[model samples]
Target: MTGFHYKGGLRIATLLCFFFILDQPAYADGVRPGYQVVSRAEIIEAMRQCDDYDPTATTNGARFQGEMILYLAQKARARDPQGLPLFIGYENWFQAFMEVTARAEDAMPQYAQLSYQYKQNTEIDYRIDRVIREIVEAPTPELAVNVRIWWEYQPGKPDRYSYMDTLSTPNLKVTNQRVMTYRLLDFGNWVAYDEIKGLTGRPTSGILGFLFRIIGEGHILQTRMAISKDGLQFNRATAKKGFIKRIDTVTVYPDGKMEKDIPPDRPDLLEIAKRITQPLEIDYAELSGEK
Candidate 1:
């Protein structure tokens, strides 16, 4: 039920700078270069203290978390010029858990008595919730975050898949294209081969062909995300359905330079997607050998 997510852009003018920005780091025993790690609670608490934030707000939790992530990067960079902002998908995890809740609410028919299990789920959800810190060392300061939504391996069940597609320019104009920067991972439970075979009346012996596997055995399945951006709008869509979207009601560039970035109207896990990608349009442009 675990996966890795890395989102970066290019057109770097010099391989040296690109390598300097990325390749210099060497990993050993869980230590990451350019920054240090802090527990998710520390980040979350710090965010609450970031401003006169109202806890009663609809996305109070996420707003604070997002602010903390931003301020921490701004602070860490000031202290360590070479630091990059590395945010682990802690909020992503929370949103996914919320989706579980949403699912239960919708499918009450199949999961009536299992309501007691929901409480236990929340505790585990928080414990695993986390956001790792990293420093931004790009030649030009960039902003972007990676989204990793993959299929959880489910024992005896088929692995779910997902991808994304872009919105038209007009649609992008209205929504501001922020939803385009993430992947739509499915953590949902899927039908097992046994369950399908029961209805299909198919043979299950020896995989029918005698020695092969039809489905993976595990609990979760997911797919990776691809990203694209235009002005304050971005898309993290695949070629089709089964994707997660984070649309912006207002519009602004990620770097805050354009002043057109949009605040999301829907902040729910399935709806609102935070700016996971840091402000990097400028940095990426510099890398592109452009002025």
Candidate 2:
């Protein structure tokens, strides 16, 4: 887990500028009516204030603050529907912040237990815990609108991974849009088997081990999925620079029928892909909170 460090002077300056904007009559409502753009500075300030509100300061303080932030964000979004971008940004930040905090606390006990059991130098890296750094609209066809959520691992870490999740829909103004596409880009880490074998033993030494030896330690994995009126399509790819490259795709019809184009030689890989693609029936409408 990474600690949150504050730069007081920089934050103060940003807040001062935000207050100046808020004081102007034209921007009295916390929005620039002409451009229909919410003040980024003010958004930043609100996020900072949320971060500064320590829920653990007193009994149940954290829960209270969390609820308050959620309420305020919901109200803000309703008050200025045109400021959806700003509200969404704040919501993403707050969600990530809470996730990181919870994961950090959870990891402590798990690490201790693992260390005791192994009697070796062991550390738990909450690999999936990330902070949503930014959210921006992505360019897409005129019929659809899209947004990307950028997330990063622990700040300032040398091996930190940065990635983005994209969500797009054909109809942005409606809640009944069933067709959607979700993409997860740059989400996996690559490391050689020899590097971490000491920590994680060679569980198997058959064909899998041989294949690993041929390829380098680290391999990147990426996946994309499309959900439409017809059905769902999922594609997964794995690659090791100049070594291994393969892609497998699967399609599921609305009638609960599935088809695949996996190579017969790699049934193991096909099985893995099937497992990964299983249970991917996420609700896009619920996820986007459009309704």
Candidate 3:
């Protein structure tokens, strides 16, 4: 159970390496820009022209609703590959999410099968105002938000579900866990919690224990990567005395054990985690002026 921390809501921080491909193509513009991308500059202006947003539906119980989208936008873009656009179209994605959430809640009382699946619940709406706030505040690199959900349906009685939780997968799609976990398991370097424990007969605590034991009692090590930085731009200055940068902050397990750096080239766990929790699509334009 020693895994990623659920920051308020669930977001998979690791990825599986199993094979399954997507058939959808990117927009005709080579990279189709969505309103979320456009709203970056228009965020504050949008807020000025904005009104109240019903807080009950947004994720973290609307902690990221209203004026918060601006920061959230920045956080989403910071990790983007320069010119990447927002995934979903329309304005006020968060507002759209609120509406959807409201709709889901409303339809819940009457709608029967609709309860099994709904897009909004998986991915939190990437509202403009909220995006802006996260960008300016966080210490780490800002990244676009996405999520994945797991559903349980019996064979003949598909309605009866024993348990349902968002399963971790490595991809940015709000798909079921089967696809997500498949991707990571394909990665040659990755080893699953269940499989590893089954093979290793020893009473190992967990992956954290494995990491710490390697760093402490174990005696095999080497440097991972070397990125030299002296006069700022290393690409521009070919001739300069660069120094090695050592990372700080030791990782501590629940058992109070400490460890150094984690395994290298182990199929970027964070990205894997990221891919698993795909974002739910929402249209923000529907939320303009609070209708």
Candidate 4:
């Protein structure tokens, strides 16, 4: 829930450049033809402001605190298919955390009410929120990447995940993709929720569109993604600019193989592999030589 703003003064030069060339095809929407590859130092410097980016602090203060409490409550309540508690390895610590929450509630009355509601609704619709961050540096040092992924359950609304990166040049922050998803059943499967109108790839045609449908039926790997440098967009468009977002999908097989809709040569997708997919421990043989 972090408010979308970089820490430095707006680069008037970049803004002027954007205004002078806003109508360019690269600046507008749709698949970008290509991207400029920058040195490791440049990538790092572009994303310097993002080192302090905090996703948890963007929303109202109470919501995140409430979200934490609810998340813990759901974890404590999770059950396996056999109707057993899912806290196999960390049961004791999880219970201790619950007890601490109880103590907190004793210290604060409102905490008790929130905790009770969250725990009670474990059987009903609930949300499980998680965030993961990683940095990947290739051996050639061609890319120094910082990736932040947001994959979370949003009960009552269309569940979705987002990928953001700090590799966009000059401004290292941009959201490459955000896709909607939904629970298939209680058996732990989710499909892309794209049947609704107004989504990026509508009419559900073409390879990418078909890929979205296939991914809908597959076991969602639940991973998150990129930033654009030139003509890049911000989460908060102060100067009428936003992140250069693309709606793309991928399929993860049972054996851990991945097939993405993006053509292999796209630089954004290459960065996605290095910055996000590699960290998940899925082997990308093409990037096998990368560190």
Q: Candidate 2 lDDT, tens digit per residue, 186-280?
A: 11110000001111111024454455556534333333332222223223323233654554454433232334543356454544444444322
Error of 2 at 103 (Å): 14
Please state the error at residue 47 of candidate 4 in Å: 20
Supply the TM-score for candidate 3. 0.19
Give the poorly placed runs of model 2, Cα more than 4 Å off. Answer: 1-158, 161-210, 217-224, 228-233, 236-240, 251-291
Model 2: how far residue 82 lies from native, Å: 14
For candidate 3, give the lDDT of residue 230. Answer: 15
Mark the regions of model 3 whose C-alpha exceeds 4 Å error after superposition. Answer: 1-136, 139-143, 152-259, 262-291
For candidate 4, report its TM-score: 0.20
Quote the lDDT for 112 in model 4. 24
Off by over 4 Å in 1: 1-35, 55-62, 84-291
User: For candidate 4, lDDT tens digit of each residue in 150-223?
Assistant: 12224453332122211211111211122221111111111111111111211143463355455432222222
lDDT of 3 by residue, 231-272 (tens): 000000011112322212122222212233332443443443
Please give the lDDT score at residue 155 for candidate 3: 48
- Model 4: clashing residue pairs? 1-58, 2-58, 163-225, 164-225, 166-172, 169-229, 233-242, 233-243, 234-242, 234-243
Name the top TM-score candidate: 1
Ranking of candidates on TM-score, top first: 1, 2, 4, 3
